[model samples]
Structure formats: C-alpha cells, structure tokens
Target: EITGLDDKDTVFRTVPSDDYQGRALARTLKEKGYDKVAVAYINNDYGTGLANAFKAEFEAQGGEIAGFAAHEDGKASYRSNLAELSSGGADTLVIFDYGDGTGLTILRQALENGFFEKFVGGDGMKSDAPINELGAENLATFVASSPVGEKSDSLDIFNDAYKAAGGDPDAIFVTTSYDAAFLLALAVEKAGGDKAGVSAALREISNGEGEAILPGEWEKAKKLIAAGTAIDYKGAAGDHNFDAAGDVPGTYALFEVGADGFEVMVEMK
Candidate 1:
C-alpha cells in the first residue's frame, strides 16, 4: 500500500496493506456520523498513502474533507498546521502519523491550541504514548483504527502460547509478526532449504488450497512438507490466504482511549 513492495516476487507480507486500513478508517468515521473532518499526515510514504486513500473514500461516501495537508516530522511546533486544518469548520481531525513520533507532537499541539474538538487516527496513532502523555481523560473523543485478527482456533492457540511465554498476546502486530516468522520457516522447509525457492514455497504453503495447518503444528507441517503434501497455514492472525500479490485482506476495528489503555469500540467493515 505505502511502498508498493508487494509487487516484488520476493516480497510476502503476513500483514494487510494500508489500503485496507485507510478504507476501514473512512468507513468507521462515516458510520459514527462524522460528516466533516480534516486530515493531517506525515510527509512520508506511509502517511501520504493512507491519507490520500482515506480522503478518496470518505469523499466518495458523501463525507466532507474540510482540510488536508502533510507535515515534516520532528517539528517542535505544529500549532500553525493544526490551525490551518481546523480552519474549514471541521470539528474532527484525522491524523496519519506515528503516535510515538511526530504524531505525538502534532497531537499535543492540537490539544493545547484547541484546534479540534474530536480526534481520529490510523493504526500509526494507536499507541500508548498518547494516553500516557496526554492522559486518557483528555482523550475521551479520540479514536483510532487498527487491524484485528479474525477470531479462530488458530488465534486461540497462539494467544495461549504467547501468554505462557510471558508475553502480551494483545500487543500490536504480535500475531502478524509471529505468523511471518512461522511462515518463513514453513517456506524454508517446503523448499528443502533452498533460499531461491523460498518465495515460491511461500505461495504454495498458504494459497488457500491444501491441508490446514494451525499454530503450534510444526511437526505436522514438517511431516506434510516432507511427504510432498500441500499444507495451508491457518495463522494466529488470520488464514493467510495470499493473493497473487502475496497480500492478505485484513479485518479492522475502531478503538478508543480507556482507563487501562486502548479498548475496542466497534469492528470496522
């Protein structure tokens, strides 16, 4: 979505692209009855790509984009930027930047300057930094869109294992990260340790047509691979049914700041 790296044959992602996330964010805002909003994005591939996608979809769905602009990271002040964004009479501001970096700066300035009454963010803004830095009470109207793995036995198995290892299964990107590593191992096994064959093997192992292999089923997967039987991986995140581009469609949810941290507010379509 951002870098277009999925076009490369050697590249395979266990995670979904920002294209899906952008659309999901737009749908979330619209469903929540926000008819007008402003968008602020970082001046990079990730931010620009998601911002544009959201703008296109939101406008197509009869929503109004009051303002849109990109900003450089590491700026000490974003007050002017926030003012410009809020000038179009939009009470909601959507941000496409990382919460731990320039996004935090922008958000802080926005709040102090009273630029917008409500706030929204993409996955990048779904971080603990904001709640810790700004306080959850001050962010009651803040929400973010993030990918959520589909509920399944595969997810349950992975969650249990992750917990037993003293890790937080709910951590962001943990499921996808684990799935990527496991899939790579499976690809290596299916390719008989040939690096050059790993890409092709990756496609064959999870193309949605084969024996279903769940999390923690390494022995079963290895046996199937050695026996020349195709095995499709049901990953902890989701069934990684890779498309022609080796990309997986994603499911998303809207989350809001809570007393403990972020809590799911609703599932996004």
Candidate 2:
C-alpha cells in the first residue's frame, strides 16, 4: 500500500497550474493595449501567487500595475477594496477570485459604486452564477480569461472517458480533473505502480515523451517516450507544457457576459 507522501523534492500539481494562466492573462491584456491594470485577488495561495505572477509579467511587458488589492475568502464586504480600486483610476481590472457568487458580490459592489470599466478575471472567476446573480445587464462590460477546456484535444478524449466512467463531461472542472486523474494513472501504470516511478513517469510524459494515450497525437508520443523523449503534453487546458518553474503552460479564452450569457471574445493561445 502506498501512503501519500508530501515530499519537498516531489512536486504534485492538481490543476492546470497558475503560472501559465497568469502569463496568458497578462499577455492578453497587454495585446489589448491596456496600459493601466488593477488586481484584486483572493487572500489565498492560488490567488496571491497568480496575482503576483500577473503583476510581474504585466510590468515586464511595459504595463503599469495600477493597484493591487486583496480580499479574504468568505468575507461579505469588498466595498473598501472596490472603493480603492475605483479611486485608483484604472481602466482595466483583473480579479483573481473564485466562483460566480464571489464574482457577483464584487461586481455588484463595484457597479453600485459606479466602478464600471473593462473587468477581467482569472479561471476561478469564470462561472455562469455571477451573470445570473448580478443579471446580464450588470455584467455587460465584464470579461474573464480562463483556461480553454473545450479547446484541448485531450479534453475531447477525456470527455469520452469521463462519460464512459459515468461522469458529466460538460462540467468544466470535472472533465479536467478526470483528465488529471487519468494522467496520473497512466504515469503510475508506466512506472509499474511505484509512486516515485509514477511521478517520474509524469515528468517524462509531460516533457513530451511517452505514449500519448489520452487522445489526439499522444499515440505518436509513445515512440518518443520509448526512445526516452522529453515531450510536453498539450492537455485539456490547452498547451500544458511544464515550464522550468514547475508550472504548466496553458492558454486562456476571453469571455464576456452578453444577453445570451457568456460569449467567447477570443482564444488567447
């Protein structure tokens, strides 16, 4: 029996990874010619880390970080922070929070204070609940950048496998989580069921070597893996190549809430 071990040297990732997501968002905002940006992130590991990465990248690209704010999760009020952001005179706002409920709260408060502008969000802020909560009218000018799940070739196969496993393939996080599980399982299988071996196998597969078993051109990668090839796995989140910082490179899609719900503005690959 393998007991779960948390080793400092052994890094385990649970999702699409934040570094890529952060960079993608920064790049998209810069490309849109937004010189001044503000960040309001949740006070958590994921939120703070992503915000910092976004700030670093945005500033590096000759962009200005207008303001940075932090909100604790489960807090009821963001009026103070929103007021600060409004006073900052930022044209673009990047929110690194989660769920539609929180988003609605922030949006509602911001709108009430007349802080209307081009609002952007991270993956966690991509949800229909916010639109439903604040009503489409309130969110008309809001946009969010999230990992493109449907755009991933692996997601197509992961959807099939998820259905085969009696799961809902349409649920965004569920399918991606399923893909993560399958990736781990495949790595374990290739490692002969050794946990350490599995980790190594994952690194190998992620580095672009291994039998692409999930979907798309993964099969072609099998030869490379057999030949000890280092390959990057373009996952369900789009372009999940592990970077030197142990972060997976992914892509994001810009979405806006319109009368018809969330509509895709552009794919930031």
Top TM-score hit: 1
Please give the distance, in angstroms, between residue 141's alpha carbon in candidate 1 and its true position after superposition. 0.9
Per-candidate TM equals 0.96, 0.76
Error of 1 at 166 (Å): 2.1
Cα lDDT tens digits, model 1, 58-159, are 999899999999999898888888988999999999999999999988888888988999999999999989998999999999999887778999999999
Q: Write the per-residue lDDT of candidate 2 for residues 237-259, one digit (tens) a residue.
A: 44444444345544457888778
Clashes of 2: 9
Clashes of 1: 0
Query: What is the RMSD, in Å, between candidate 2 and the native fold over all Cα?
Result: 5.4
Computed on alpha carbons, the lDDT of every model, listed in order, comes to: 0.89, 0.69
Model 1 segments beyond 4 Å from truth? 1-8
